[model samples]
Target: MSTSTMNPETADRSRRALAAEQAASLAATNDWAHVDKDRVHRDWHELYGEIAAAITAGAQPRDEAVQELVDRHYAIASRFYAPSRDAYLGMALLYAEDDAMRDWHNSYHPDMVEFLGAAMMRYAETRL
Candidate 1:
């Protein structure tokens, strides 16, 4: 199948829905307080590198990679921290505020939404 087969708009909508659900699930949990900050940061960096590599490799369909990254981060975050809607929203906002993240987000034109959605989901999963 071609990349064109995966409508960017539709994929973005699906990703956003997933993110919202994950965020809500996280909000319902209570495990964010004990999160290991250093470890989560390290893992985030590692995953970021992997994502960069995937893009560099010219991977045909990057959504899967994005999804996996999102899933992994969410799992890690949920395991590490306490559930707080404000904290989750803050983290997501922080990413948008960072220059590096902005660059990374801009690097992939049509896929940026997917990447952001994945990141949000990952953050949400941390609460679970």
Candidate 2:
């Protein structure tokens, strides 16, 4: 078996790329009216728990794990029905102010805010 060591920079870039891809996928999907919000929230909590456990188990690095969490969070949020562009934008704006969002942004080595914002803007454009 061969093992490779990833430098911090490469790992950071990979995590950001993953987040971007996830955001784009979420944006591209057209259906949302049938999503169950409560179920999504519960799933998010479960995913977060899994990530935390993975971190504790050394299965993944914290940065990568947190990026996954953010990706899942956005994917779930993207499934919600927003009646108008204003409503969608309002949710994004509210996300910007959310404590968990801020914590995720702070935890990443790269500029997660910029990356996530770009993805979110693309999501908005797809809706328009």
Candidate 3:
């Protein structure tokens, strides 16, 4: 549950694995065209970790700091496809409900999937 104390090597491995997995998933969905897989992986790797840390620090979904992070997340996602408010909220639902996606997010923090889903939904409601 405490990601702050997660070993650097292990974290690096996790990030690399998630990045590759995400890139492959995007490619499979035909959404990787013109998308820099490496960059996408890197950005997501950093962003996910940062969001995990913020959540661990007790930032709520509607908190300013958490919202800022979600902004970055939205921007990164927009590179692949523009999302309407409903679509973004739907993504939050997918992250929380999809076993694979939930497992992937929980790899960073036990509460990652729930926290991220809430944050994304809040972002969609307020900003998207």
> Against the unseen true structure, what C-alpha lDDT does each candidate score?
0.53, 0.47, 0.74
Q: In order, what is each prediction's RMSD in angstroms?
A: 8.3, 12.3, 10.9
- Candidates, ranked, lDDT: 3, 1, 2
lDDT of 1 by residue, 78-125 (tens): 574433544454445444555686666556544543455444544444
TM-score of every candidate relative to the true structure: 0.43, 0.35, 0.74
lDDT of 2 by residue, 36-118 (tens): 86898788667656554544554422345455554565566656533233333334443355678756643542334434443
lDDT of 3 by residue, 1-128 (tens): 22233355644554554455556667776866778879988998899999989978888878989989999988988777666665565566556656898898899889988787777766866886
Lowest summed lDDT window (length 10), candidate 3? 1-10
Clashing pairs in 3: none
Q: Between 2 and 3, whose lDDT is larger? A: 3
